[model samples]
Target: MLSRTLLCVAFASASTPLLADTVWLKNGDKLTGTIKVFDGGKLLLNTKYAGDIPLDWKEIKTLESDQHLLVKQDATTGEISKSLQPAEDGKVTLANGDAPKTVELASIQQIMKPKPVVTDLVWKGNIDAALDFQRAENDTDDYNIAFKTSATHGQWRHNAKGEYNRESQDSLTTTNNWDAEYSVDRFFTDKWFWDGRITYKRDTIEDLARQRTVGTGPGYQFWDDELGAFKVGALLNRTDFEYSNGEKDNFYSVSGTWDYNRYLIGKKVEFFTNGEVGKPISGVADYSLETEVGLRYKVTEWASLNLKAEKDIISGSDNGDLDKTRYTAGFGVAW
Candidate 1:
């Protein structure tokens, strides 16, 4: 039995010369039989017994052999041979034009393999619950409640969110708000994606009046599989007053955002900034800018506390109209 094993080993070694070959460097250098890989700026070759060989781009002139060839010219890929050769003395030969030039094989830089895009599917979703007791100087102090949930599957995603706020003065009237937003994400690549969203908000002015709005837009999401994500997009929204004296209005709104997830701290955390530039396309409302910046701290694995301050931007409008700034801080949980 041992003799049989020894015979197999000897056979493998004998055939290794064909199955594996050497890559000759123009600088009187050589690499034994190995597999080669090229990355952004590096060159590499791997040998079964030895390991990987790294080479500098400047050190190589051309890669060629009787069997295979890989050469890069003007920039990369100067093929020294008719076809791209694989696993020779070098991963590929640096194409320096058709001229003969002396290069140091020792100076050859081995390339590194590209970071493989993980095919492993990862899915994460969460719900959020929050309550807010806010103080507005010279205005109404109110309690606000909100909920948000989101999930992603491969290139497609879904997000749902809703908020309800009950606003009351120290002794006067009360106001109530109900809002909901839903979005779908479509991916072009891991780095680039577009999403579509529909949103609606209804406000009851504490028994005095009610107002509502509906809108939709296409947006971009820069969601890194690692780190956090940011989104930028536009919305065409219109508001109608059912029992209020305010004018009805339709708006062309552009928005941008930057966000970060909890990476440094073990606890969940996120920082976000967003802004919108809007122009009233119909009815009578002023063009405006609205910006907000905030931070969120995880209260649990599926929930967090959110705090935000916002300001409105006004341009091309004379009157203040319905333009106002709001500051919001709240805590919410999810499972």
Candidate 2:
């Protein structure tokens, strides 16, 4: 038994040399590490001391690898190669075997695992929770929890999200909210898409006991890259609302949604914002708007610290206190 364990350890140690790749920077720096990802003009390398470091591709003079890589040249063209060697005039030689090809570095748009790599449906999500407590002549407690998930396959993307918030003062409920939303997008072109969304929410602070909205429209992706994405959509929607005073109303509206996200500081920090606005064509209110902004610091691959602020405003309200705002800071996990 001892001999078998020792043999396995020795075998693993002998195979370590085959995993390394070499990167040469324009500044005459040479780094040997494992390339994990290269996207949006940045490359991620896993090094012994740095763990994972992101380097701008423009700073790299050359890349040499014996590991198999999937390189996509354009939207519809791709190739698999086991070697990348420098060629003349900003070109690289992709060697699969005896048939070697040269392509310009700027022409390569994306890279991933080698072909025959079966990609399952991409699924990702995050969850966060926060709590605030105050003790004085009157005690107050606040809790907020949120979850979001998304799945993508080919040109179709789907997302679902939910949030719950509650506040109590002197053991009496002061504010409570429950919200959920689902959306789907189908892409026919790189920049143009169709989207549909549904939302349900109940809020006490806004004097809204229940609200439901449904919409579908055309959307445009301004840009979607490794650094971030920006998108805008115009929707025609139907909304129904029930107030706490037992009053009910419904309306048809023209709505718009916009989202923007960016990553900085070597992808360790993120800034995100999204907003929605609607103008009623057959209702009492002139307009309604909701917006949220968030900043997140990635502590690890799956954990982060986040701060968020949100605001909602209704242009004309039966109740004077229909406008609401909130701020929360907490931790989140994603995968």
Per-residue lDDT for 1-335 in model 2, tens only? 99999999999999776657778888888898887667557777878877667778778777877777877775445677787876764577899888999887777766655534433244666798888899999999999898887775556879898899999999999888999999999977667889999999988766678999999999998865445668999999999989888898898899899988887876688898888999988746878998889988899988999899989888875554357899999999876
Best by lDDT: 2
Which residue segments of model 2 deviate by more than 4 Å?
Answer: 1-18, 22-33, 38-109, 113-122, 204-206, 318-321
Would you list the clashing residue pairs of candidate 2? none
**TM-score of candidate 1 against the unseen true structure:** 0.49
User: What is the lDDT of every predicted structure here?
Assistant: 0.51, 0.80
Instruction: Please identify model 1 stretches exceeding 4 Å from their true place.
Output: 1-141, 206-218, 235-243, 250-268, 289-291, 310-320
Question: Model 1 Cα displacement at 14 (Å)?
Answer: 46
